[model samples]
Target chain A: MIDWIESVLHITVQMGTLYLLASLGEIYAERSGILNLGLEGMMIMGAALSFIFTLAYGHFAAIIISIAAGILMSLVLAVMAIHMRLNQVVAGLAITMLGLGLSGFLAFPDIRKNILLSLNPALPEQALMTQEAPKLPEISIPLLSNIPIIGRAFFHHNVLVYVSYIAALVMWFILFKTRIGLSLRSVGEDPATADSLGVNVFLVRYLATVISGGFAGLAGAYLFIGFHPFWQEGMTAGKGFIALALVILSTWNPLRAVLGAYLFGGIDTVQYRLQLFGLGAQSPYFLAMLPYLITIITLILISFENLRKRIGVPKSLGIPYSREQD
Target chain B: MSRKINTPFGVIRIERRAAYPRHIAVLTTLLAVLLAFLAVAIILVLIGIDFTAAFTLIVESFTKPELMLNSVKQAIPICLSALGLGIAFKMNFWNIGAEGQIYVGMIASTGVVLLHAYYGLFDEHVLLPLMFLTSFALGGLWCLLPAFLKAKMNVNEILTTLMLNYVAILLVDYLIHGPWRDPGGYGFPLSIKFPDYAKLLFLFGDTAYTGLLMAILGAAAAYLIMDHSKLGFEIKVVGQNLNVARYSGIDVSKVIMFGAFIAGGLAGIGGLSIVSGIIGRLRPRASPGYGYTAIIVAALAGLNPWLIVLASIFFGGLLTAGDVLQASMNIPKTVIQMMQAIIFLFILMGEVFKRYRIVFEGKSGGDMP
Candidate 1:
């Protein structure tokens, strides 16, 4: 019983950490009035790039290169929507299609092989079964980890989990408290007015997209290196879209986004637990779809007028700004 | 960039502007699409495939009569769905749930097929129409939710429709894998092969010529509706300007709902044709993402039904060519998708050029005319 409890907790922490990082990045982009529907493709691209790079180089270098690639791709979106003044939604969709096709083309041949053997040549044959995932070093504070339930949940986690929490807090602080945050909000709210105030609306939007891309890349890296430690085709599996929905459900608040991600994570974790507890064979697929069902429900609920008025979205979200038009 | 004069009422006046040459845009889009194909060709050449032989294989695949018939057989669903979407786009209603509606229609048609096979209530003649009606009803019903949400609640229909695609996909996957799995099939995740009573008749010997005929008929019907009906006028008015439509007492919501219903119903019929004519058994990945591809077809054809037929045939030929390239040239099937994306991007860019003109003026001079 104790071992089962420990394993469930471990799974929850891993899933929650991955989702929290990705949703936080989505929060930043949506708050800036840009809906990056290409998140799924971006995450997949990041995962593939990180996986290949980590196999060739080490962990740190792979993470850096993946982040750079993600930012570079996001720049294309920024150019089409901001400079060319194309429709944001369609442009985002086009980018997603391009990313998916490119990644599939690149990863098709190598995906069929056992990638782990190329990465770690020193492991024994039996170790392959047990070490399906490479263990990340956990950081347990000497005194804090010994407390009660809260201590085990919060203090005893890997470096990536800790970084996700810190990153969420930093995002909340920067979005709510800083001058740049104010400018970003203003640009999202009314780019014409923001530009009239000499706020450089285009530049702010470009920077926000690039930063969001970097965070999303890190999210993908976490999926590869921390959660499963394996690569699969089309593996990001709609998590990026869920993150986009979570941004709306959280009312574009980064802090609320963290809470929302963990809540979804908990639901997903419980569904898996239910399956493990001798449910029928088909239960897992249904269980896996729970988070997506909740997201759709949440979207419908938020579309209610009173609810939306209470937690307002940015007024001018997804509308491309044209300087000449104003 | 040019001017023409016309005498409509015996008065010749200089028409300072004419519509941008659509043929040029189409040619440019085709050129861009071919350039993307050429890039794949270069890639194949570098990978040690004989590029010329591969190109010949693709070209020959399109020229054969049987292959051309097969291409049209496949293009039917895409053309039907694109026709429906073209109507909705004309009214500025972005109904992206044609995919889900297609699945719903398939589910409905399959239900009818099972009923007829088990109960023996209707002859084959009656059964076919009943199956088509059932599919159309289910497809329209599936679309109604997103349409209702958009018209009544101002929800973004794009996201809602998109989300519904996954739900429909999962629902179909669940059914086929569980309750609907054919007992006699030895555990394969599929339904029973639909009986002859449920199948669509062939127009010629051993070909899905009836399906092709239905697609052509659908295109004609859509053309008549958009060009010669009062409802079409209302749709056009609403698309051009909503306030103007409202001011004219056109009931914009009703128009939108009507367009959506018909569009969705047509797509549902398309799905029915696929199962009844081509595949014969329900499977999880029944569509090779044809519903989404219809979006490109609709846009490429400029929302005209006749042009949509042409565009669908063109795209369907491309799909066949891509398959040939995959087998003969060692090229990935994703190259076709990449080319489609490139074409869509260039078309969108062409639209920008159509709507706005770029002017350059000297720093110290007045604006150039």
Candidate 2:
């Protein structure tokens, strides 16, 4: 039973980091009043771009390129939602569609071959679909990793997982304990007030949005290189959207995001465990529905007015702010 | 939102217009569309695709009769869903759950067919209509939950609706893989082939006129309801200014629920059209993101019912052309998605021009601020 629990926890931590990275980024964006629905797009682009670069230049270059792609995708959203003052919902959706399509198109076998050739003429022409890159090396913390099950589940993992731990902690500090955090919270809570208080609403929003994209990109890189090392069309699957929901479950708090992400990750990790438990014979697909269904329930629970107030739902979220309007 | 551009010579100032003429709106929209195409072409060129060849293939989708039929078939569901979404959008409701609504619609209609086979619940003549009604109701009901939450509790509809889409899809997957799985069909992840009575009649070869007919009627209904009725006026007024609508004694929650129901129902019928009218039976992944594509179609059409038909057809052709391009040029059909996103981005940029006028002030002289 202990062994089973350790294994589940191991997988949960591995999967949970994906959500943690994404939700942390999203928490920042939402805190600055821009709800980016394009996390899936940006993440997938990261996965796809990283896979290509991982094949050509190795993991370091792949990570950088993936981050750049994410930043580029989010920049498009920033321009649409902030500069053009378009509906943030539509802009985010468009960015997601663009991401999905672009990633799929770029990863097509022939396109992948062509891209690889462009990167290195000496490289043999091959489809990326059939290839796998070396997984990120696991870094077991010496003292912490000595602690049996918890150590194996949390401490003995790839560098990306540790980065996520640091990222979440740093983000939590930045969001709640700093002047910049105050600026972001003020902008999201009341941009007009923030603007009058001499906050550069556009610049703050632009930076927050872009930073979210960077985090999303890093999440994608971790998803591809840290978790699954293979190149599949939609390996990220609905993880990006799930991460979006995680943001709400965490109530847009980075610290809470770790708990929320791991909880969902535990749910995700239990798909096989349920099979071993014999419930899979009757309802494996139903189990697949758990995470999403729970997300809806969470949304409902969070939406209660008093609960929302306690949770600190951003007041100006999804509303575009223009200086001239006020 | 700086409306001023600092230049070496002068500062260009942008100011909002009180109102724009219809001609300006039309012109700007056309310009946006053109820019979208140009951008798509440029992207294609950069990706080493023969732009002219791809363009020719896309154009052929319109000129070729057989391909046109495919486009029309594809357009039917998109048109129906977009027309439905137009109702909700007009009231400023972001009902992105059309995708989930579409899935539930498919599930409901599929349920009717399976149940009919098991128990002979109704006569053959009533089967199609029953499928239509059940799918619409289920789809609408699926949408109503989010609307109710949004209306009553101020829940964010976007995430709830989107999350439900995955649940509905998983339900479909479960049904197909388990209870509804075709027993004699070699353990395939599909239900039994829908009976002859359950299928829509085809007009030419595999092309069904039923879908087209339904799309037209749906557009007309949406047109009349949105442009003619008191409900339509209330919805518009509510969307324009919720405070004013409340002051004028409009039942805001009721309008939201009703509009959402209509939107979901239409999207549901779109799903029904796909299973019954096009594919002839339910299967895994029946929708290739038509619910999402419908958002682009509706927005591109400016939420006008009649224009949705044209926009849907245009997108339907693009979708068909993507497949053709994939088959012939080894180009992924997702290029169409890229183009759609570009078009949407350009249209969004055009919205700025429509609402504001930019004037280049002579040189950065004194009193510019």
Candidate 3:
């Protein structure tokens, strides 16, 4: 029973990191009043780029290149939503479609051949997409790893997992405890006022969005190298959207995001363990539906006007910021 | 109102337009499409594919009669789905769940077929209409919760509708893989094939006459509601300004609910057309993002029902072209999707031109037009 509990908790933390990293960045973006609906696109692109680069170069190069790819993709959104002042919703959707299509196009066997051929020329071309990379090494902390079930579940993991823990803490601190965080929050809440106070609304929004893209990229890389380590088409499969929901559930708080992501991760992990609990007869499809269904339910629960107000939902989210209009 | 920017040699002014001529908007859209095609060609060239050969194949897809007919068949569902989305978007409701609604429609219509297959209850004459009504109702109901939440609680319809889409898809997957699995043939995840009585009547070898007629009728009905009805005016008013709508005594909630229902029902009909008319029965991965593609179609058409027909056929041809490109050149069909996205982005950018005019003035005071 103890062993079962530890493993479940272990899988939960492992899976939760995907949401944790993605949502943390989104929290920053939303805190700066930009609703980027293209996280999925960025994430998937990150995964595809990382997988290819991993095959070509090493893991470090793959991670950096993926982050660059994500930043590049988000730049499209920043230009549209922040610079061009297009409707953020439509622009985000366009970015998503672009990412989805571009990633898929780049992942094609022939396209991969030409790409890898150009990159190295000496590497094997056959079975490129199916090729695996060296997984991120797991480092267990000596004293922490020996504590209890929680120790192994929490402390013993890959470097990215630990990076997520530090990332969340640092993000939470940067968002609430610093002047930069104040400027970001103020910009999201009221860009006009923030601009009046000499905050560079455009610059802050651009950075936040790019950072969000970077985290989404890291999440995607973690999804490939840290979690599944495979290149199946459409594998990310709405996980990006789930991370979006986690942003709201966390109420734009990076600290709260930790709990929300893990909770969702627990829900996801529980689907696999349903069989172990003598509920093996339940269809895996229905179990798969839980996270999405719960997201809707969460949206409904938090949608009460009073709750939204009290929770301090960013006021200018999804609205374009224009200095000329101001 | 205008905003002026000082460049090194001149002053550039961007002035808001009260209105632009219709022809200019049309021209801009056409230019955007041309540019999108050109952009795709460039991408293909960079990847070492022969752009001219690929372009020739795509043009051939449009010229061939049978392929044209297939494009028309593809147009029907896209047309229906876009029409439904047009209604919702007009009311400023982002019901992106048409994909899910399509799945539910398939499920409901397939349920009717399963019932008939098991109990032999309904005759051939009643079967099609029965499937039609059930699918519409279920599809409408699928969107109702999000609509209700958006209306009453002010929830984000985009997220709710999107989430439901996955739920509806998973529900279909469960049904096909579990209860509705075809018991006779193989272990494949598929429902039983529809009988002759359950299948839609086709005019050509593969194309459905009913689907075309339904799309036409659906557009006509949508046109009547949008242009002639009081509800249409209410929807327009509500979308333009909620405060104005409320001040003018429009039942905002009722209008939103009604519009969402119609929108969902139309997408549901699109789903039915795909399942009953195209494929024979329900299956997993039935929709190839028809719901999402409809968003582009509706937006391209400027939410005009009549224009949606033209846009759908145009996009449907592109989809066919994508299949051809995939088969002949070993290119992924998502290349077409990339083209569509670029087109959408360009069109979105073009909206700036429609709304604002840029005038260049030289510092020397000689370049004003």
DockQ of each: 0.33, 0.69, 0.72
Tens-digit lDDT track for model 2 on A67-123? 888888899999989888889888888888888888888888887877887887776
Q: Write down the TM-score of every candidate.
A: 0.88, 0.96, 0.96
Complex DockQ, candidate 1: 0.33
Task: Looking at model 3, give its docking quality level.
Answer: medium
lDDT of 3 by residue, A1-326 (tens): 99999999999999999999999999999999898888988898888888788888868988998899888878888988897788887888888888888888887888877887778777774536454666788899899988889999999999899999999999999999999999999999999999999999999999999999999899989998888887766668889999998998889999999999999899889887885675754466787777777778878877877887888889898888986753
Rank list by TM-score: 2, 3, 1
How far in Å is the alpha carbon of A51 misplaced in model 2? 0.4
Across A23-132, the per-residue lDDT of candidate 1 in tens digits comes to 78777776677877767667777776676656555577767877787787788777877777777776776666666666665555522123335556654555334313
Against the true structure, whose lDDT is highest? 3
Residue B88, candidate 1: Cα error in Å is 2.0
What's the CA error at residue B363 for candidate 3, in Å?
2.9
Q: Model 2: how far is A150 from its true place, Å?
A: 1.0
- Candidate 3: regions farther than 4 A off: A125-131, A275-281, B202-208, B364-369
Clashing residue pairs in candidate 2, if any?
Answer: none
Q: Is candidate 1 or candidate 2 better by lDDT?
A: 2
